[model samples]
Target: MARITIIETGHVPRKYRERHGSFPDMFARMVRAADPQSTFDIVSIPDGDALPDPRQVQAILITGAAAGVYDGLDWIAPLEEFVRTAHANRTPMVGVCFGHQLIAQALGGTVRKSDKGWGIGRHVYQVTPNNGVVAGEQLAVACSHQDQVIEAPGDARTILSSDFTPHAGLLYANGTTLSVQPHPEFDADFAHVCCELREGSAPDAVVATAKASLAEPLDSAKLGAAITRFLTRR
Candidate 1:
């Protein structure tokens, strides 16, 4: 069985957690659904949890955070360092949302809060040519992010993109790293709750649109399988 270490960067709000479990919990469920033989070890860095040895970990998966990559928090820098170390070790690493941005920034890419405002809803991404990271040519996913990787790392190539987030997914040239701006672990119900949670913080219209878009078809499970493949495959 492959062992996967999930670096928990942050948590869901108390209210949201009560209804939909924590972020790590969500990821655990999704990964299990994709690959039942896989085992997971979650390390919560925000709670001051120490990172486990990368040598013992078969793969490293980074979870999304409520904080932005440019927030300059003490833990942020260390997390980036850890990301670099994992890359150097050639440990298969998968990043989601903030994780995606952090991986890019750590590997000489650029990430910044977009003037494009928040991308919150079921967004569609057109898979870049000949990049087999994603299963489909076009995929719709759950997204909630204001920050984006404006410039990809020197060795990373774009794998998935959309009009709102042109650099939605990235794959390092070494083929050991993958990252995406959307949350494949987020099911439709969770996405709906997130949309509702943003009622006051986001524009009313945006919130409503997000909530409505959840009714549309989502390819989260397919993406989950692809993620499982990336981590488990040699």
Candidate 2:
């Protein structure tokens, strides 16, 4: 079995947790949906859980969190340190949303809350040619974030981007790390619920547009498959 460690950063709100479960659970299910032979180990580092040795797992994945990399939280620096260690070890690593920004920030890149405001719902990204990281020329995935990786690390190659999110996907030159600003684990239904949950925080118009955009099909499966390929590729 392919062992993957999920470094949990945050939990879904209690209201949403009862239904779709926590973020780590959603990610675990998504990974299994792409490759059933996979097994997972979840470490909630934000809850005082310790980071495991990077050498212990076949691959490591960082999950999305509500927090930003520049938040100055106690755990943020430690997590960045862990990311660097994983990179130095040449261990395969995958990051989603907040994880993506954290990875970039940890590796000499810049991440900041975008002035373009929120990017929610299913956004289409133009895939750049990078062997097979992107399955097609365009990909639509669920997104709910204001912060973004403004400047990708010097050694990182962007595999996907959109007009709204220029540095949407990043692949490090070391060939062991891949990150995306959107969430491939989130299906349209869950994405809708997320939009609804953010109704109070986000603008009503933004939420309405995000809800309306959910009708379009998302290419989450394709992205998941690409992530699996990256984790298990020879």
The global Cα lDDT (0 to 1) of model 1 is 0.89
Q: Candidate 1 residues 1-234, lDDT tens each? A: 877899999988887788788888888888889889888888998788998777668999999998989989988888888888889898999999999999999999999999887889899999886787775689999999889999999999998999899999999988899999999999998888778767787889998898889889999988888888889886
Q: Write the per-residue lDDT of candidate 2 for residues 93-195, one digit (tens) a residue.
A: 9999999999999999999999988899989999996545776789999999999999999999999999999999998988999999999989888899878
Off by over 4 Å in 2: none
What TM-score do all the candidates reach, one by one? 0.96, 0.96
Could you tell me the C-alpha RMSD of candidate 2 in Å? 1.1
Candidate 1 matches the true fold with a TM-score of 0.96
Candidate 1: segments with Cα more than 4 A from true spot:
none
lDDT of predicted model 2: 0.89
Clash list (residue pairs), candidate 1:
none
